[model samples]
Target: MSTADGPSDKNIGCAIYLHIPFCVSKCHYCDFASYAGKSHLLEPYLNALLTEIGSASVQENTRRIGSVYMGGGTPSTISPETAEKIMSAVAKKFNPSASSEKTIEANPESVTPERLAGYIKAGFNRLSIGVQSFNDRNLKSLGRAHDSQRALEAFDMARKAGFKNISVDLIYGIPGQTLSEFAEDISKAVSLAPEHISAYQLTVEEETPLWDMVEKGTVIMPEDTLLLEMFEKTVTSLSKAGYRHYEVSNFAKPGMECKHNLSYWLGEEFLGFGNGAHSFINSSRFANPDEPEDYIYEVDTAGRAGAEILGDEKDRVLEFLLMRLRLVGKKLTFKELDEKFFPFGRHDKHGPRPLFDETYRHPLDWISKNGLAEVNSDGFTLTHKGLLFLDDILLEFEKV
Candidate 1:
């Protein structure tokens, strides 16, 4: 999991993403493409996915797909037979390596010893178990179907099934979760010694049950200040416990950063399948409708969804800023970036040389002045202080 150099001289090939849209139950704060009562649609949904994969093959020669990420709605909620069927379709459509970092997002309860075995047999080498919160009370509040113990058991099962690459998902900043409890959770988690941890601060989406509760005065979402405090605590605690804050919300044991996510940060191209799945190829991203019936029907009947390309260069520039700010110590080449991306006065810099652009204002000056980021012969990178303030700095990329 140490950084694999992804094409030093040039970038080519694409990533394949499959979204599994079935969850045993919905989380209170989730609005992802999923439904608890839609079990009846799995067969047709999967057929649609297969059709999409088949269609994707003819788009380009579809060479050397670097990774395969099966995200959820609890990808493991369905049987491993489902995983195999998807992989079988993928293999027919692309040249995915046996060693090509195959990953599946799993909820603890969905991962039994038998299912783990099936996953291994189906060619999944990596597993990211969603253990959202270590506190059982918070788990209930969040509507996680699996409890704390179940998450541990799932980890054991994943190990027994011969997965060397493993990651766990954790959530922080619950309505009443204390910092001490959060620390304890990390302490307990580090004892298990997973290679990766994606510790996310909860964000209540507008249409979620949690949002409705907040509207009814039944639930209280954290304030931005509180969320910032929680993120700070997480960085400190995880660092002390021997985890590196590789990305803004992701921590990892040395050499275990998630390569799939890294692709997103680096702005690489990828294709996706399944209901409500989205894709980015040659600088474009489009997602399918959330309705399973509609998505399935479209894919099965038409084999492709119409896509939206980022119309202007500004979108790509803004996207780059948003993505790179997530990494702790990585720099972009400004001169090269300007030559390739900016290429004009679209940025409306005050004067003289091309000092900046509208899409990326080059917070290099401000961040460096505040000791948050520094520029070298390359471009810039976040300092430790800057990493703590990364979100605020990233927001600066937006209009003032």
Candidate 2:
């Protein structure tokens, strides 16, 4: 896919994220702030969400919204009217650009013709369908509600419903999964010809069923080498299929990148609404209460949900570096870094360094010397081999 440039930073447009915390069933490895068997809370939750949206102090005149993403446990499970109401509230609050990209996340089993039509009518131009795996056994093992066939059908249905910009999400490294099986999954997804693809490794979070199973020896994760092999295969296969590996875990066909997610990775300001939603604006970062009841009660009683500020200069710099490195696999330029994090001239004759660079310089130097990254006029960029150990590299930065 063609890797076209995204919107210029000078536009100053922000993004909006609306969280839908409902799902038909929770996956074994899932740890997001979503709940199952909470269908009854849908009405009250939507009401609370609408109230929060309406009450948000967004400066629409100054910061025009470029994108709005409706993500959740399964946003498609909600009725069309509810979806419409949510979009209506957004329309009432924000002034989206003429070509604003609006996306909604849905699970295969929860998607339907009616839901697709409703989403389009509500101004959603992109759909992210979670099809974790195309293998029946893997789907069953993951406790996902949809099977391989159902996932394909859902994709077809979305296409028929006029969703041209579609993204499919796939997971790799499931317990007992073989390399060939993963390759086949990638092949199937390529055949479907989605505009975008996101392939993530399965992480066994603590307190989750998958973690319990691993502790009990009932589930065995793939070895590190095997996982790396899978990652390599994903990159190779997707690249061959005309998808650009734009981000570490995401691929897109030409100008089809997920703009909303790019906003986050690029460190742009955005407003998030609903339970457990986070917002970064005016140099302040905060999150609403994670629990639905807490969120509802707070919004109802206080006329606004409370938020906890993240922290000061050091914290913001750390966050900005962490998020930006994941894109273009590169470090920030001295001028860029200085302007955003330390405007008071932290650079010397050699180059610019952050406040905490004293402790981190050695490790970063090692990374550069070891060829894990390259530093030059542009900035530091991870080598192809370095992408595999991205977490380890980021940990070194975190220690500083």
Candidate 3:
């Protein structure tokens, strides 16, 4: 609703997230706001998206646009020409810094040498390929259109296209995935030596196809112990391969952490465009319509979508803490918490009271005693074991 301003906004820039919600086919486990049979509406959606960017430009704030991320329903599904058009619109409106991290998410089957070249020419510097697994069976079970060979080829094509900053995404704990298979997948990803890798556990969301299969007993997920083993294997393998466990599920070569995503985890401002996209600015949040037709109509009639204020300052503090805790080696500094939030110390008139204060020292001490976390005079960081029980750790903070 309002522009972001504060001590924290000094030199920090806002990240831009553009959502492409059309997919060739839906994944079995995906519940995102993506449509499989919406190809015909792509043109209209793109036009409306351009208009939205133009509208935001008129009301531009002081925050410099530091990064632009094109995420999907398979952003690679679009033609390179169309992708270039979107980038052109962005460049015209925002004029992002030349050094900004521009990333586009692509699927293996949708990737081609020509498309990859087009992206590089359009000023994109980073490519994130969705290679969920290197096994064909795992691919089929997850409803991926590309197999192992295609994924491998996609990487080679990206490299040949002059993309130096590449990221590979993977999923573990599939219904039939074994720890050994996951290890092999990690091994393969390491061999490629992409700048970044994101390996997430399979979460069977409610009402998804995967959830139904689980409900019907048609597919049985691996046991919790096995999933933990898989997670351990991911961390150990990635670490040994010279990747830093920068976040819970993200690994990166030194100094190669994803800038756009890191901005989010650091509780910085971001503006999202296109249907089903979201924005957070000045302690308020906003969302565009999920449906293409609805979003187009709204942009045509209102120039912008509706805004929803998430909560008061307390909620933001909790959210910030929760998000910052996801950073593996990053500390939850009390100085930052105090500066951005409780400016008047713990006794601030406007207070949620910082979670790391003396009041919660008991639970913090217990966490330290169990070796799940390390709490110090400065702040706390989750031990590797603590990451495994992150939810449980968060519950301790929520209890206060």
Candidate 4:
């Protein structure tokens, strides 16, 4: 960790995520809160974010943040000077510690040597670069701003800038993406030798341009069988390359797991800050309005939400299980299960609902019997099959 300060038991349990909402250009498939051409809003947005974080800081009983993740539209899209300002305010609240996992998400297009060095000076220790593909045609099809060469150079520059723990993000199952091209992308990523690799399947969200393309006559969506075949190839290729499939979409070298992301996966609470950032604390989950102007105004002055503590306990428990099951390798013990794992509902008479009992027995038995999960003295975990059908099984939780 940087020598900025130290973390304590009180504050270290929470992870802080600061959303940077400006990208040079938005990828066609992206649904994140990022502006493609809005360079003008950067400074004011930063000021608003700082003011909001300051307000939350005063109210925070949680002492030190365990990790600080600078994710988003494109964190590195800002000039190095702007990066310093954001990092400075973040330090005032979280205080980057020796043990803190300080991560910043950088797009390949923004990873200049100076940018990388500036991020380090700003106290970011982990770098997640968006290197979504190594194939030219596929890269173009995805509307990525960087070419294969730029991505390679960006990765090289980050390593040259002394980023010891780096992660590269790759996407598979793009329209017209072949199994061979996908494997080649994984092979190239392995050759880079990053500390971690996050291989995500391309799922077209309803409002995304890629989805619209599928709706129109513009693009061909990969079939289910082909996607499954691609998924298997990805698992095989990455495994042979020494990357462990630690989570459904993430792979890492041993001991290089993303602590901030893992916290989310394991159902821990975090205070998500910034425009469009989502937070889960005290059994409720919600977000600041996704509009940059609205988010900044509300969070800076009133603090996140117009105070929306929306979503109930059952919704909370189901959401938690959905995220946790993404971690195919780890298991949460029963000791950690009780009140936190399975949230209960009030009946019509204001008593515990029948599903509360179902949480303890039915769901676990059903999944285990179906070869979707297994449990020991430790609590349940997704089996290999479970990970692939994770979303499907999570739907079951929503029902219970």
lDDT on C-alpha atoms for all candidate structures: 0.77, 0.84, 0.85, 0.78
Candidate 4 clashes between residue pairs 3 or more apart in a chain or in different chains:
10-63, 11-63, 11-64, 12-64
Give the candidate order by descending lDDT.
Answer: 3, 2, 4, 1
- Locate the minimum summed-lDDT window of 10 residues in model 4: 1-10
Candidate 3 C-alpha lDDT tens digits along 207-291: 7999999999999989999999999999989989988888899988877778888778878889999988988887678888788
Q: Best by lDDT, which number? A: 3
Q: What residue runs in model 3 are displaced by over 4 Å at the alpha carbon?
A: 1-12, 57-61, 346-363
Best by TM-score: 2
- Residue pairs with backbone atoms closer than 3 Å in model 2 (clashes): none
Deviation in Å, model 4, residue 166 alpha carbon: 0.5
All-Cα superposition RMSD per candidate: 3.6, 3.0, 4.3, 4.5
Count backbone overlaps in model 4.
4
Candidate 1 per-residue lDDT, tens place, 1-400, comes to 4333221223324677898888888899898888888889888888888777878746543556878899978789879898998999888888687877789999997788999889888888899989887789989999889889898888888898888889988888888887777777777777788888888888778999999998999987767777677788888888888888778889888866777777777677777777677777655677777788888778766777645654566566667777766776555667657765756644545443453432344566677788987766556767778877766786666543
Which segments of candidate 4 are over 4 A away from where they belong?
1-12, 57-61, 299-306, 333-335, 341-357, 375-378
**Regarding TM-score, does 1 or 2 come out ahead?**
2
Candidate 3 has a TM-score of 0.92
